[model samples]
Every structure is written in structure tokens, then in C-alpha cells.
Target: MFGESSGRWLDSELWHACAGSMVQMPPLNSKVLYFPQGHAEHAHGGKVDFTTRIPSFIPCWLSGLKYMADSDTDEVFVKLSLTPLTQENTNALLMDLEDGGDDCGNNNGGVVEGGNQEKPASFAKTLTQSDANNGGGFSVPRYCAETIFPRLDYSADPPVQNIVAKDVHGNCWKFRHIYRGTPRRHLLTTGWSNFVSQKKLVAGDSIVFLRAKDGDLCVGIRRAKKVAVGGGEVSVSSVVEAVSCGVNGRPFEVVYYPRGSSPEFCVKASVVRDAMKVRWCSGMRFKMPFETEDSSRISWFMGTISSVQLLDPIHWPNSPWRLLQVVWDEPELLQHVKCKT
Candidate 1:
């Protein structure tokens, strides 16, 4: 069923390369493709592997290619071309897409990359209304920033920072920051980290932490919007649904499986929040016991946070990331959604 699955499995690595940049010239004309995973039962032979599952090769003419991190392989590749536009314009295009949930070829309310020559005020108005009714807005309570960023080494490794803010309608909006630095892994401050544990974050889930109108930290989990497994087109409505339908309460995991290179070894994971130490800042450390399958049974691994990078807001300025903790879970599932046992 893996090969015949309708969606594409975007290389997480491509997400890293494309991170913080805006107005990407994708290798393909902003279209999705379908590729097969070597596992599941439909490979050319009964056996398959990551190298065997790399998506069809598409090269970018304008954008340079980069990977998410060292361990990433070609299977994580995403089609993106480098653009010659300013970081601001590039960011604008990206922010526009993420905000409006529209894709490159969207013409109904057609917004062009490197276009928008109209008055700045008009453009600003259009941009602000993009997600107005959707409860998207950006404003960080000074307490939230002081409480989170500094702890994440924002003072030292500052990359772009972003926060989720809300409007009178109880709608949450994301605010992103643009900063200078080589990208680093972002950490959730003590409060938000606890919040994640409270929410049981999975791979595709997006968590938004905001200062509630009542002046408290609140979190929202937006699942990673899925496209076709290997590659296929996704609709804007689907993206909006991903954001709008985000779970707004604490979550618990039913099973836990660490990330792996093989398929047979994979298992699902479920996490329920446990109150640990409170009031820790970003980058603060905590210990958790994780169980993984070595061969047949499970083994325990002591986990520590290696690093944390605040998602660049300029790119996704109005999206949320307050309690966004990107910690390493060995039994990490390849995708965020839980698979059936």
C-alpha cells in the first residue's frame, strides 16, 4: 500500500533548506508528485530501503539545493528553485501562501510573487485580512517572550523568531521574527515544553502557545498538513482545515515509537502530559525515559535536548511556536499522524 498511497512524503530535509527563505522557485511548477516507499508490500522486489524510495529527481534552476541536517538523505528532497528576490519579498510570498492557504498557481484572488506593485498601504491591508476571520493574529505578551526566547539562547544564537497572537475574536495569529545567525535547533522554554508534554506533540502536529486574553500561556496543536505520500498536489482548503481544526486542549499518546531507518521496527507512540518542574526557560533541560525496539523487544534511551531553533517568523510570521519544542525522540515516527497498531 505504500507505493500506491495517494500522497507524497516530503523529505523533512527539504523543509530545512527551504526554511527561512521566501518566494522559492520550486523545481517543478509547484506541483506534487507521487512516489513509492520501499516498505509496505509494493516495491519492485519485496525488499526496499530509504535510498530505494527517493522521490523522482526534480532540479531547481533558481534556488540552490540544501538539506535539513546531516543525517538527512535524498528521500527527504523537496522541489524548490532559488529565487533572485530580496529576502523581504521572498518572505512576503511565503507568508502570503502560508497565511492564505493558497498555492502558487492560485488565481481566484491571484497574488503573484515579485508582483504586488500597488500601494504599500493597500498591500498591507490585503495581507492583514488574509486570515482575519480565521482567528489568526500575532502579538507576544512581553512576559511570553521574556519567558521563552532568552532561555532558548535567543541572545546568542538568534535566528528569526515568531509567536502566535490572538485577536478579539479568539482567533490566533502567528507573528514571526527575522534574525541573524546560522540556523540552530529551537527549544521550547520550560513553560511551553511542559505545555507540549501536556499536549503530546507528534511529528506532524503544530503547537501554538499564546498569552490568553486572560493573561496565561495557552497552546494549540496544528497537525502537520499531509500531502501525497511520495508526492501529489494538496488543496488550500486542506491546509486551512489543518490549521483551523487544530486541537486546542491537552493531548495524550496511545503508543510511542522512535524514529528508525527500517519499517518492521517502527511502532506508534502516545504521550500524555505529566507535570514536571515548572517555570524553566527555553533551552532548559529535562530528562525523559524513551523506549525503543532494538530487535524484538524494547530498550530504554535517556533523552536530552541537543538544540532548539525558533521557527523563522518572517517566513511564517503569523504561525504559532511558543511551546514548540523540537526535541529528539529516537523512536520518533516518520510522520506525525499516528499509525494503527
Candidate 2:
């Protein structure tokens, strides 16, 4: 039903927001490589001394993966335990694990399962340059307006209405949706620019609009990696703190930011083993399965492997970190891919 399952069009929002949405534990008893150098990158200026004390990577066995989130921002991170496997030497694995994990880590009773879960009508729109410009207006698609939005009274002179939507952080935003213009289309005119300015939204960032079961409008944001502004949302102190906690044999957490720029200092053992079995080389095309929402719908991002090279051949010889240079179908969404000039 994938063909008909999505009411969403080819806009990049649905793909960015819901695709690969599930964040799971890195299963206990699995073998993994912990990269202290990569972890220090996130700690950029924090001068995390763990990088020097630790080798480029440490062979370890996954003891735990407890999912959690920041109380302030509702961002998902994982509390994990990795014990050093002194028997296995470093740089033994030749392929890196996929940097994949996604979840809001709500303290509320985990995720709601079963197909009977309420799924209201939803529409996602990626703001165009015009929509995010200084002009205070966000153009609304006709289908979205007629279906997900509240009905309008055409009899009114200008046919205008005030709409309120809630963000992931539970903040309320009001927009003046109006029907006016030569061809007569729906647009969020009054509060659109204000929302964009406050959220720092740009052309590529997506705004998802939906009708809740309670009949209220809900809005969510999906930011592309480029908008991360100065690396990413992970702070220098936070990265150093997480790695420090890990070294001290206490549970530490890492963020699940699945972008090329954000390297995975923590990864699933099974995913790494499977990837290591592949003899990846130049000119290999593959479809990566990325699930979202209920975890039932599956979407794939097509890509071609361009070359296989060591990220740090000098310091970490034969290390698999970012070893494969590839071109993804949606190159604009990733930062570290090999792009043609």
C-alpha cells in the first residue's frame, strides 16, 4: 500500500521528517567500535582529553542502550554502556556501522503500537524561497487547505480565519489564513513571517501540518542539515560529557542526528557486522531502507558508492570511519558526500 499509503507528494518534508524515524537500542552482547576521535569532533573546542588517552577506536561489546531525551527540547539521545573487549585489537573492522537512530524518547509509556492507533490527516510543505522571504506570507496548497484545515466561510467578504497550531515543544503559533489574490488561493499571511523568523526557518526546512484527533491543527518542523548553523545542535560540552561518562564506566548518551555531518560514536553491532561482509567498491548502487511513523511504511534512499578510502589513514590506519565516498539520490540533504563540481 506504499503507493497509496502516502497522501504526501514528492516534497522533501515527508522524506526528511518521517523516514528512518525509529530509534532503537544497539542490542546487548553485540560487538562495536567506539571512536573517541570522532566523539571529540562534536566536542570541537571542549578539549576532551579522552581522544588522546583512548586510541583511534576501541573494540567493545554493547552492554546496554537505554533511550532517553532532553527534558527541555524533547530531543532524543541514547544512554549506552560499552565495555572494552581487550581480546580484539583496534581497527579490526573494515566497514563502519550506519549512523542511524531516531525517536523523541518521550517518558510517556513508550510508543503506541497497533494499527488501531489514531492517524489523522496530515500535510507537509517545504517552504519555498517565497514562503520564507521577508514578505509575511506562506502560500498554502489547495489540497492541504481543503482537507486538513478547517472549513472557510466563502460568504464572508474576504474569507479569512485565524488558525492556531502547536509545535513539538508544545508552543502555540497563530497564523492568519486568508483567501484573496487574483486567482484566489489560501495563504498564511499575518503570522507566517514571524514564525519563520523565530524558528530560523529557510527554504529547505519543512513545516508539517496536520489535523489532530481533537480537531486542532498541529505543526512540526523538519530542518535540513545545512540549517544546523555551525556544525549541529550538539554542544561541545555535551559531547565531552557523554564521552567522559562512557570512559568512567557510567552510562553516557549520544544524540541520534542521522546526517552525514554528524558521525556516530555509538553504533549497533549487528549493523556493523553485516556491512563488513560487503565488498563495497566504486559503482555499486544500493537502496537504503528508512522507516518512519508507525514503522510499517518503508522508503529507500538510492545511492552509488564512488570510492573506498580511509578517513584518517595516518593516525587510524585501516579505520572504517566514513570509509566509503558515495553519492546519494538526495545529495542536498547530506554534507559529507562527494559532490561533482
The numbered model that scores best in lDDT is: 2
- Per-residue C-alpha lDDT of model 2 across residues 293-341, encoded as one tens digit per residue: 2233556668999899987676667677778887898966432221100
In model 2, the runs with Cα more than 4 Å from the true position are 1-38, 45-124, 133-135, 146-148, 151-160, 200-205, 210-216, 222-241, 256-260, 286-306, 327-341
Candidate 1 ranges with C-alpha deviation above 4 Å? 1-56, 62-164, 167-206, 210-220, 224-341
| Cα lDDT, model 2, residue 230 | 29
**What local distance difference test score does each model get?**
0.27, 0.57
- What is the TM-score (0 to 1) of candidate 1? 0.19
Error of 2 at 300 (Å): 6.6
Backbone atom clashes (below 3 Å) for every candidate: 53, 0
Error of 1 at 139 (Å): 19
Give the worst 10-residue stretch by lDDT in candidate 1: 265-274
Pairs clashing within candidate 2: none
**lDDT, model 1, position 309:** 41
lDDT of 1 by residue, 215-239 (tens): 4333332223322332212233322
